[model samples]
Target: MSIQPGEKLVFGAPSTLSDRLTHYCPGCHHGIGTRLVAEVLEEFGCIKETIGVASVGCSVFTYNYIVADWVEAAHGRACATATGVKRARPDRMVFTYQGDGDLAAIGFNESVQAANRGEHITVIFVNNTIYGMTGGQMAPTSLIGQKTTTSPRGRNPKKEGAPLRMAELLAPLDGVAFSARCAMDSVAHVNAAKRAIRKAFDVQRQNLGFGFVELLSGCPTNLHMDPLSANRRVREEMIPYFPLGVFKDVTANEKAGA
Candidate 1:
């Protein structure tokens, strides 16, 4: 009973992630996103030097989950907070953990402005299509016809508008050195998410420019589905609406050119 599931396995939990039980619902992919970020920080040896700007929402608890210096930011102001931290603490790595509601809705302007200015920071965005913690409201990234507390009749694109593709939108910015969208429904996608997370941090570590990766995660509780069904929804419906892949990676291109 003492030995945990993978206690004696080849790979254990990333030290950057605390031992505390996460507050996420069963099958929620936020844990995967957080674990990947922690692993990336560990791989880069920046767990201590990294300053996390925790955005409002369920994601804000990142301060307690990740072993890093973190500053809680006002709702939808994570990018703005990360910008200030990166500017003042140039010696440290700065990153923000945001949600679809925070990044694509209320904080859209701040996120765009920071990326445009080429702020040397990373953005770990979790887009589950709905406001996971805030009573499952329809987010800006919610797909057309995706039902939520605010869109119970299924989203009306004619009125609510189509979902926002943040990764695609951010990739075209000259200041953005890396932008990617990844999913977490399966092992392959989870692995790809790790790679994208690592690259996002590497962008700042290399002083390239603003780095951003949007992770299409699952909100099983909000979606009123069991773990398996939620994952299936991601694989079927969500993936079709929000495709995954690296939208941009200037660092990779430069290396290829070299």
Candidate 2:
């Protein structure tokens, strides 16, 4: 236990993740977010029983990285796929990893109905604001004045409407057991994201209701910024719009006797 040269390592990649080299760009937050999910799975001892539903977009290739049983769902059908998986295999731990465009724009209905029905599952919504794949197009969650390939002139709320707040939108649903928005812009925020991810799964474990966590991640490759700058953008620009913290938690309310 000494600080000697011939000693054990302090940390290593979580067993829940594959050794495959990530294809994500430098400073991209997907890698960090994926690791957080894998760590949660390992800590919960549910890796062996976990079934991940990967949606189309940059996140579609998540099956290549996470070391778990995964199924590829069409562009925005991840939530429906996860719902079916959970229903068919009630003993398995089911979750979906989705991007902003995939979950908010195209798969919006599925995401809504899943939460509205209080499906016993977890949904990890990664909101980077821009569509990372398909050449960095503007996404439904793209903030006003945020430039993108599709919105080179910056998103105009008058034309496209304001950014969609999925966490805030889903938090009030009657079937939702947990809902929160988190950012991975700093160490403190990363820790908070981990707690939210764990609680989402814990909600499923308790057979309460639908659990959802929307993570405001950074996309340097898509945002046309360096890794560090992308992180700063998340903190400075994204946080004010999306905000971070739990929007709802039935368990917390019950514990507080609310």
Candidate 3:
């Protein structure tokens, strides 16, 4: 439909995303995270030159939602796979969409190693605390005292350890050009998330070191909460532990090789 005179277009689906609806569970923030990536890709006008790696998890089918060249990596191996893709096609914008279990639990080594090596790729990590797929088990990033199938009585710091703060963990790496954490619970946070995502992609385009963005998301199904409650939990609970901000940014530095 043509826009009438005096009418302004405000919102529409990003062309980088597929026309098909996402398969994420109700209240899940994976859809929002994926869309934000697509929007940034569209804004960069690099969708045609982009290559996405989808790992095994709730976001395993990210290829179906994001309209771009894609490779499906094994559980917890997205970072390793993405490293190869970026090395093979230095001209293409490379990124990986991964979840807490895949990125922090199973693929922790790969995630850290890739960052330490400073591979020119962007990583979008969705931290929902619990594993949304494969029966709502506890993940490495599950909050303290948080209940999950594996931790029925709630996580015990003495035995289970605290949630892995990936952004903070990766920020200090010499190879990491950018590292940031953002929440998806409110309009303001979502806008901040978009900005973070844009910066993550920008680093790759500039051939900087590794770019990492951790998104604090919600898994309503696993959390046994409605959409609203899940969002509130992210705002009130997750955000406190995993603070949102650019933990490390090379652009912010002035001294050379400091």
Residue range 86-191, candidate 1, lDDT tens digits? 9999999999999999998999999999999999999999999999888899999888888888998999989988899999999999999999999999999999
| Pairs with steric clashes in candidate 1 | none
Per-residue lDDT tens digits of candidate 2, residues 26-114? Answer: 98888888999999999999888999999998777789888889988889999999999999998999999999999999999999999
C-alpha-based local distance difference test score of model 2 = 0.93
lDDT of each structure?
0.91, 0.93, 0.93
Q: What are the models' TM-scores?
A: 0.96, 0.97, 0.95
User: Candidate 3, overall lDDT?
Assistant: 0.93
Q: Can you tell me which runs of candidate 3 are displaced by over 4 Å? A: 1-8, 255-258
Runs off by more than 4 Å, candidate 2: 1-5
Select the stronger candidate by lDDT from 1 and 2.
2
Error of 2 at 82 (Å): 0.8
Question: What is the TM-score (0 to 1) of candidate 2?
Answer: 0.97
Query: Each prediction's Cα RMSD?
Result: 2.1, 2.2, 1.9
In model 1, the worst 10-residue window by lDDT is: 1-10
Q: Can you write out model 3's per-residue Cα lDDT over 68-164, one digit (the tens) per residue?
A: 9999999999999999999989999999999999999999999999999999999999999988888799999999999899999999999988889
Against the true structure, candidate 1 reaches a TM-score of: 0.96
